[model samples]
Target: MATSWNGLSSVLPEESYMTLITALAFTVLWLLWSISSYFRCRNRLPLPPGNFGFPVIGQTVEHLLALRTADGIRQWMQKQVDKHGPVFRYRFVGYPMVMMSQPEGNKFIFQNEGLSNHIFWPSHISTMFGPHAVITQSGERHKLVRCHLNRFFDRAAMGRYIHGVNCNAIRHFTNHWQGKEQLVALDIINFFTGSCVCNLALSLEEGPLMYRILEETQTWIGGLYCLPINLPGFRYYKALKARGSIFKLLDGLMEQRRQMIAEDHVPEALQNDILNSLLTVPDEEGNLRQDSFIKDNLLILLFGGYDTSSVTLAMTIFYIAKNPHVYEQILQEQKLIVDGKCSSGENENALTMEDISAMKYTWGAIQETLRLHPVLTGSYRKTVTDLEYEGYHIPKGWLLNWNSQHSHYNPKYFKDPFKFDPSRWEKRPPPFTYLPFGGGVHLCLGYEFARMEMLIFIHHLVRNFSWSLVDPSYDGPIIRDPLPRTKDRVLINVKRVIAS
Candidate 1:
C-alpha cells in the first residue's frame, strides 16, 4: 500500500507546484488587463495624434537626462514633431508627455483655452518650492496675487527704480574694472546685473540673505527637474535638503516681515513691493493665511527676475561684441533718442515711458537673445481630466510637454531661426510664438519688472564699456542645469571705448 501511494504521489503534480502556476497565470492576466485598460481608457480622450510610448518610464530619458545642453532639447523635439506630426506623445521616465508643436496646438495651450495656467511641475517641485510659490498656484488665486503685483509693473513704479538701477550699474562697473582688461568684462557685467536685480527688488540691506536664498532656490529648481529617484547622497537628495533649508529660511523671514507689518513699520505705500503686497492682500476666502506664501513666492520672483535678465544681458553683450555692426546700429538708435531726434522728447535727465519706448531696437535685441537661448527648454502640464484630440485620447494624469523651444528654433516657423537676428522680432511673430515671459493667466508677474530692469541695466552698461570675449570660441556646451549656464563663466575683456 505504501509503495503504491509513493508511486502515485511521484506521478501527480505537487500542490505547491499547482499553486505557483496559478499565481503566475493570475499575474500575467492582471498585467494584460492593466495594459488593455490603459489602452482602452487612453484612447477615449480627444487628444492630438501621437504614440503612447512605453509603460511607466516614458520619453523622460531623452527629454531630461539625455539632453543636458541648451540646444539638445530643441533638436530632440524637432525630430519628434517631424515623425509624429505637430502633436505627439513622449514618455519621460514613467510619465507620459503629450508634445504639441503646431500653431493650432500652441494656440490651444497658450492663448485660447488658457492651458498655460496649468502647473505641471513634478511632485518633488512642490517639495522644494513650497505650495505657496507662484508655480504651484492656479486659477483665481493666481489672479489675486497677479493683480496685487501689477502695481509694481506700472510705468510709474519702473520710473522710481531707474535711478537706483543705473546707480548700481555704474558703481559696480567703475569699482570692479579699475584696471581690468577687456577680457574680464563679461564676468563683471554678470556680477553687476546680479547685484542690480538684487538691489532693485529687495533693498540692498537684504542683499546677502536674498543671494543665499536665490542660490539655494536655483539648486532646488535644478534638482526638481531631475529624476525623482531618492538614492542616498544623490543630486536629487541634496536638492531636497537644500529646499528644506530654503523654506526654513523663508519661514523665518516671513515671521520677521509679519512682525514688522504688525508694528506698522511697513507702510501701505510700500506694500506695492513684492513682500508687503502679498502680506497685506488676503486670499479669495478672506482668510489671513500663513506668511510662507509671500516669502517663498518672493523668493521665486527673485530667482526668475535676476537669472533670466542676466542671461539675456550676457547674450546681448556677446552679440554686440561679436557683431559690431549691430552694436553701432543700437548705439545710433540711442544717439537719436539722446540727441532729441526721436519722437520721445525726453533725454538722459529722466527716462520716461516715451523715452524707453523709443529704443525699439534695444528691446528687439532682448527678444532675439531669448529666441536663441530660452531659459526654459519646454513647458510641462499634467492632465486633470480626460481630453480628446483628433480621434485619439489623452488620459487624465498624463503630462503634456509644450515643446516651445522646438517651435522657436524651427526654420519653418522662423526664417533662419539659428541666426541671432533681433530684426526678426522687428516684425512680431505669431501670438504664442515668442513666449519667453510665458502666457496665459500664469504669465510671469515679474515680466514687466524684468524687462524694465534689463532695458535700464543694458542701456547703462553698453554706454560705458566696450566688451569682447577673452576667447571667442568659449561658446562650447552650455549646461542647462540651472538656467543655461555655460561650461565656463563667459569671460569678456572690457575697456572704456576711446573713440578715434
Candidate 2:
C-alpha cells in the first residue's frame, strides 16, 4: 500500500508542468531580446545632450503642456538650454528630435534644404493642410507652386492690394467698434484679417458665405495641435469634420468661378485676385491646375493669412497699450505719416503703398512685436540623410527643430531679451537669430503681405483710436494651438482719437 501511494504522488499531470515551463521560457526570451535591442541602438557618436524622459510617451506630455502658454514654453526651453547647451536631443510627440537654438545650428539647418524638408508635421497637421498644399510640398512641385503664388505678393501686387486691405480695416473699425466702450482685441482683429484675406484671395465679399468660411476655418485651426484620435468627441475629429465642410464650401465657390469663366461672366484681366490666378495658372505640361489643387492651396492661404497676422496685430495692440512710451513713439510715427499726407493734399485715411513704405518707425514696432510674440514658435524639418552638428550625430529620418522663440529670447542674442524694446530692431540682430517669418527655401511667402497688413492696420488704428487694456494686470499667457493667442482674448477699452 505504501509503494502504490508514493507512485501516485510522483505522477504529476504532464500538461500543467509543460504549461509552466513554456511560460518561463517565453519570459526569458523576451528579456534577452529587449536587452539586445537597447544595446544595438545606444549611440556610438555623442548626441546633443538632454534627457528623454519616460518610455514611448517620452516628454510629449510635458512638451505639450509647456506649449499651452508662451511663458511656460520659454521657461521650459530655457531650463533645457541651461542644462544641455544650445543643441540638445529629446523625444516629443513620437519623434526623436534635436532642438537647435544657436545661430550656427539654425544656419546649417536652413541652408541645407536638400538634406532637410518641411515634412515633419504630425499626422493631424498634415491632414488639416492637405498633402497638395504648399506647406506639405517639396522639391520641384514646391518651387512651381511658390513661383505661381509669388506673383500675387510682389511689390506691384501689394500696391494694388493696399486699397482692399485699408478698406477692410476702416470698415471693421467703423462698423463694429467705433462707439463701443470695450472689446476683445483678438475677436476684432480676427474679423479684420478674415475680411482682408477673403477679399484679397477669393474676391469674396463680406456676407453670409464669408462668415461661414471664417467660422469653419476657426474650428479647423483649433484642431491643428490635437491628439489626432478619431473618436466622436475628440478635437481632432471635429477638426476633420470642419475641414470637410470647408472643402465643400470652397469647392462650390470654385465651381461658381469656373462656370462664370466659361459663360464669359468674368473677364480674365478683371479676375486678378489669387483664386483667379490659381485657376488660370498652367502647369509645366500647359494644363490648368486641377480644382482640388486650387481649393487646397486657397484654404492654406486663407488660414495662413488670417491666423498669424491677427495674433501679431492683437499682441502689438496689447504691448503698445501697456507701454506708454512705446505708444507715444508709435503714435508720433503714425501721426507724422498722417500729417505728411494732410500737408501733401493726399487723403488722410487712404494709405498708398508709398505711404505704407515710409512708416519705418511703425514697421519697427511691428517687427518688435513679431520678435517677442512670434506667430510660429518654431518649425520642423526632417533629415533625408544622417547629419552631424556641434559634435553630435543626428541620425537620418530624425526630426530637427529650429526654435525662433528660443533664439529670440536668448540673452546671448538679444540684450535684456524680456523687455519689449522696438528699438532693438532698428539695428537688426544677426542672421537666423531673428527669424520671425522663418528662413530658408520654406520661408513664408506671405511675409511681405503680412507686414503690409499690420502696417496698414496700425496706421489706421493709432490715427483714429486711443485704447488701454481692460485688465491692466493681465500679462499674457499666450495659448498656441493653431497660432499664439491671448488667454483672456485681449479685452480693451477704446475711444476714438478726435482730431483737434
Candidate 3:
C-alpha cells in the first residue's frame, strides 16, 4: 500500500496541484461572500448598541448572577446603562432586548402605543396567567379587558371594599402577630394581602382553597425569571405544573359560580365582586365572558394584587421600623385619624374611604417605599414598527424594557435618590419620573387598589402595633425577581402599641 501511494504521488503532475489550489481559493472566496451577504441582509437596519455576549446563552448567566445579589436586576442593568447610554441592546435567554432607562425613552416607548403595543412576558408567566390575561393582551382586546377590570379598581369599588380591606389588615395583625416574638414580614403580609384580595375579588372566605391558590401562585411566580428549560426538576417545569393545579382549582370555582348564578343563589345586585362581575357581565351583544377569560383575569388579579401589595406592605413596615422619626410621624397621623373618628362618635377601628383619604403622611411613606423598592423592577414591550430615537434605529419586533429602578434612582429626577424621604413625594416629581405603578395607557390597572390596600394596612398597623427590625446590624440589598423582596424577608419584632 505504501509503495502504491508513493507511485501515485509521483505520478500526480504539478498541474494537478495547481488545480487543487485554485479550487481552495474559489471555496474561500465563496465563504467570504456568504458571510458579507448575511451581515448586509441582517444589518439593513442598524440595531441599538449592545454586546451579543456568547452564542445561544447570550448574557443570561451574567443576568442570573446579578439577580442573586442584593441589588438584583437593577445593579446589572445600571452597569449596562453606564457603559451604553439609555438605550442599549442585550440578549437574555435567547431573546434580543433593548433596555431604556431614560425618561424620554420611557415616555417614547410607553406613550407611543401605535408603535409599541405588544407586552412580552416570560413563558412561565404567560402560561400561569393564560392567554386572556389583561397584562398579556394588546390593542382592542387589551382595552376591552382593562375596561372590565377598571370597574373593580375605581373609586366606587375602593369605597365598597374599604371595610373588608380594613378588617383583613386588623385580623391578620391581631390574630397572627399579637404575641409573636419574631415575624417574617413577607409571610405575614402575603397572607394579609392574599386574604384581602380573595375577599374583594371572589367573595371567598379564608380557608384551604385560598391557601392552596396562594401557594401555587407563589410557585409559579418564583420561576418567572428562571431559565426556560422544561425538564421535570427544572423551575420552569415545576412552575407549569403548579400553574396547571391552579387552573384546575380556578375551573372548579368558576363552575360553582356558574351553578350559583343559574340556580339564582346569587342576586343581580349581589354580583359585584370581580369573579361574579366577569361571569355575569355581558357585552353589547349580551355574550358572557368565556370561563377561560374569567379564570385568566382572576389569575391576573391575584398576581397583580397579592405579591406586589404584600411586598410593598412589607417594605413599608421595614422602612417605618428602620426610621424611628418616620414611624413616629406615621403613628401621629394615624392617631389623629383615629381620634377624629372617636370624637365624632364613629367606630375608631373601622376605616372609611374618608378616613383612608385623610392618611396623607402614611401614603407618602408608602410611596417612598415604592420608589426605593418597586415591586416590578421593569416591564417588557415589543415594537410593532421600526422606530428611531437618539440617532439609533430600533427595528420592528425588537423587545423594549423600561426600568422603574432607573428612573427612581436617577439624580436628575430625585435628589438623593437612594435616601428614604417620604417628604420628597409631597412635591410630585416630573411626569414619568415616578413610575412605581408605571405610566401611560398601559400603566398598572390595579395601582389604585394596591395603594388603597397599603394605606388601609398601614392605618391598622400603626394604630395597633409597633415593630422593629429583628437584626439591626443586618443590611442586605433587596431581591427583585419574583417581585421585590427583602433578602431576609424583612424579619421584625412586633409589640402592641399601648394607647395612653
Q: TM-score per candidate, in order?
A: 0.82, 0.89, 0.88
Tens digits of per-residue lDDT for model 2, 87-161: 988987778888897788789888887555444687668878988888888778888888888888888888888
Compared with the true structure, model 3 gives a TM-score of: 0.88
- lDDT computed for candidate 2: 0.83
Model 3 Cα lDDT, one tens digit per residue, 47-132: 68888798867887787677664376677778888898778998876777888888887788788864454777756567766899
- Who wins the lDDT comparison? 2
Off by over 4 Å in 2: 1-44, 116-118, 267-270
Q: List the RMSD of every prediction in angstroms.
A: 7.3, 7.6, 7.6
- Strongest candidate by TM-score: 2
Score candidate 2 by TM-score against the native: 0.89
- The true-versus-predicted C-alpha distance at residue 43 of model 1, in Å, is 10
Colliding residue pairs in candidate 2: none
Query: Candidate 1: which stretches are off by over 4 Å?
Result: 1-54, 111-117, 154-156, 182-190, 229-232, 267-272, 341-349, 498-500
lDDT of 1 by residue, 285-335 (tens): 887656677666666766676666777777677766667777877877766
Give Cα-based local distance difference scores for all models.
0.67, 0.83, 0.81
Weakest lDDT window of 10 consecutive positions for candidate 3: 1-10
